[model samples]
Target: MSKPTLTDLNAFKAVAEQRSFRRAADLMGVSRSSLSHTVRTLERRLGTRLLHRTTRSVSLTESGERLLQRLGPLLGELDTLLEEASSHEGKLTGRLRINGSEAAIRLLLQRVVPQFLALHDAVELDLVAEGRLVDIVEQGFDAGVRLREAVPKDMIAIPIGGDLRFLAVASPGYLKGKPILETPGQLALHRCIRQRLPSGKLYRWEFQKHDQEVLADVPGAMTLDSSQLMVEAAADGLGIAYVPESYAHAYLREGKLVTVLEDWCPHIPGLHLYYPNNRHVPPSLRAFIDLLRE
Candidate 1:
C-alpha cells in the first residue's frame, strides 16, 4: 500500500472531527462527494475501514479512532510549526475561525476587523455570528467573542472594547402615559420585551446602582432572542426593551426610544475575545489579538 498523502489524512481528520461530510466539506471549501472520495481513498490505501456511514450518522471505526488519537496532536504540532515559520518570515497565513454573538461581531466589523484584514492580507478570518454561545474548542473555532461575563473561566479572555451598559428604554409613544419607572421593581407595571437567552431560558433583567443590585424577571407580552430585534420591537411601540445601549442608540438619537431606568443600568465589562488557555495560539489568532490590544 502507498503512503497516505498529508492532504488525504487531513481531509479524513476533518470528516472525523466534524462527523458530517457536509460540515467538513463546508469548512474545507470542497464538495461533500469529493471529500468523501478522498477519505475513502485514504481508507483503501490503509486497508482498513475508517468510518461507518449511515443515512443520518457517521462514526469512526476502531482503526480510525486510533489513527485520529495519534494524528490529532501531530497535525496540531505541525500547524503550530508552520505558523511559527510563516510568522518568522514576516507573513501570517492561515484561517482564523471565531464564534460570536451578532452584537459582538458587529463591533468587531466596525472597529477591529477592517484594520486586522488590512495588516494580514494572507490570513482568512471566518467570523460566525449567532445568538447562542458555543464550545469554541469542541466546535473547532480558533476563538470566540462574547460578553466578558459569559466567557468560560478556563479560557483566556481579553476585552474587545470598552465597557458596555444595558439600558431599559421604550418608544416615546409607549411611555407617554405610563408612570415613570424610578426603580427596576416598577417594571412590573409595564409590558417588557422579554429576552430569551440562547439556553432557552428567559433572561432576568439585571440592574445595579450604588451598592444595590437587582435581577428582575420583568413582565412581558412579547419575547425575542436578538437584541437588535428587541430594539426594533421597542421602537415600534411593542413594549419596553432592555438591551445593550449600542443597539438602541439610533432610535434614541431620533427621538423614538427614551431611557426609563438610566440610573439602574451600570457599565459592565464589555465584549471579549477568548480562546482555550491550554492550546498553542495560532499565529493568525495571535495577530488579531495583538491588534485588539492595540
Candidate 2:
C-alpha cells in the first residue's frame, strides 16, 4: 500500500477527535462527504477499518484507537514546530479554539481579540460561546474562559479581568412606594427577575456584608437566563434583577435603575483564561494570553 498523505492523516484525526463527520468537516472547512472520503481512503491504504459508523453515532475501532493514541502526539509536535518556525519571521499562523460563555467572550472581543488578531493576522480564532461549562481538553479546545471559581483546579489559570460584583438593581418606577430593601432577606417579599443557570437550576442570589454571607431564593413570576435580558426586565419594572454590575451600568447612569443592598454586593474573583498544564501551548494561544495580561 502507498503511504497516506499528510492531508489524509489530518482529516482522519479530525474525524476521530470530533467523533462526528458533520462536526469534523465543519471544523476543517470541508464538506462531510469530502471528509468521509478522505478518511475511507486512509483506511483503505492501511488495510484496516478505522471507524464503526452508524447513522447517529461514530466510534473508533480498536486499530483506529491505537493509531490515534500514537498519532495525536506526533501531529501536535508537528503543529508546534511549524508554528514556531513561522514565528521566526515575526508572524504567527495557526488555529486557536477557545470555549467560553457570552460574558467572557464579550470581554475578550472588546479587550484582547482585536489586538491579537491584528498582531497575528494568519491565526484563526474559533471562539465558542455558550451557557454551559465544558471540559476544554476533552473537547479539543486550546483554552477556555471562565470565572476563576469555575476553572478546573488542575489547569493553568491566568486572570483576564478584575474583580466583579453582582448587584441587586430595580427601576425607580418599580421601587416607588415599596418598602426599602435594607437586607437580602427582604428580597423574599419583593418581586425579582429570577436567573436560570446553565444547569437548568434557578440561581440563588448571593450577597455578602461584613464577612457574613446570605443566599436568597428570590421570588418572582419571570425567569430569564441571560443577564442582559434580566437587566432589561428590571428596567421595564417587571422585577428586581441580580446581575453583574457591568450589565446595569448604563441604566444606573440614566436613572432607569437603582441598586439596593449596595454594601452587600461584594467584589468577587473575575474571569480567567485556563488551559491544560500538560499540553504544549500553541504560539497563537500564547500570544493571546500575553495580550490579555497586558
Provide the RMSD of all predictions against the true structure, rounded to 1 decimal: 1.9, 1.9
Clash totals, every prediction: 0, 0
TM-score of each: 0.92, 0.92
Cα error, candidate 1, residue 110 (Å): 1.9
Clashing residue pairs in candidate 1, if any?
none
Model 2 quality (TM-score): 0.92
Candidate 1 residue-wise lDDT, 69-160, digit = tens: 88987887788788889889899987788999988888989989999999999988899998888888767788999999899999999987
Per-residue lDDT of candidate 2, residues 132-206 (tens digit): 999996677889999999999999999888889999999999999998999999888899999999999999999
Top model number, lDDT: 2
Off by over 4 Å in 1: none
Evaluate model 2: give its lDDT. Answer: 0.92
